[model samples]
Target: MERRTISVTGMSCNGCEQNVESALQNIEGVTRVEADRGGDTVEIVTEDDVADDDIEAAIENAGYDVAT
Candidate 1:
């Protein structure tokens, strides 16, 4: 599996974390997604290679910004 950690901004609560997690989990090949509000970060595990833009799009769609 492939793993990536993305620093996210604008997550203030568990609900925001869930939103980010849900967005990433909907993507194809994504096996796991961990969005931590306390840490302001997101970790994604996928079964196959995935594009960074795809992941970033998901984060943007969730109303958050990902630090590059």
Candidate 2:
């Protein structure tokens, strides 16, 4: 599994964190997703060939900003 931690912005509550988590989890290769609103970070585990752009786009679609 590939693991990465992405810094997220604009997450103010657990609901926002959930949104981020849900978005990331929807990706095909993604296996796990954990978003922390307090720390503004998201940890993701994927199978193979996970694109950073795809992950970032997912966050953006959920109304959050992701920093590389």
Q: What are the clash counts of all predictions, listed in order?
A: 0, 0
lDDT of 1 by residue, 1-68 (tens): 99988999999988999999999999998999999888888999987778889999999998999987
TM-score of each: 0.94, 0.94
Q: For each candidate in the order shown, give its overall lDDT on alpha carbons.
A: 0.91, 0.91
Give the Å shift of residue 22 in candidate 1: 0.5
Candidate 2 per-residue lDDT, tens place, 1-68, comes to 89999999999988998899999999999999999988889999998798988999999999988776
How far residue 4's Cα lies from its native spot in candidate 1, in Å, is 0.7
lDDT of 2: 0.91
Worst 10 residues of 2 by lDDT: 59-68
Evaluate residue 28 in candidate 2 and report its C-alpha lDDT on the 0 to 100 scale.
93
lDDT, model 2, position 1: 86
Number of clashes in model 1? 0
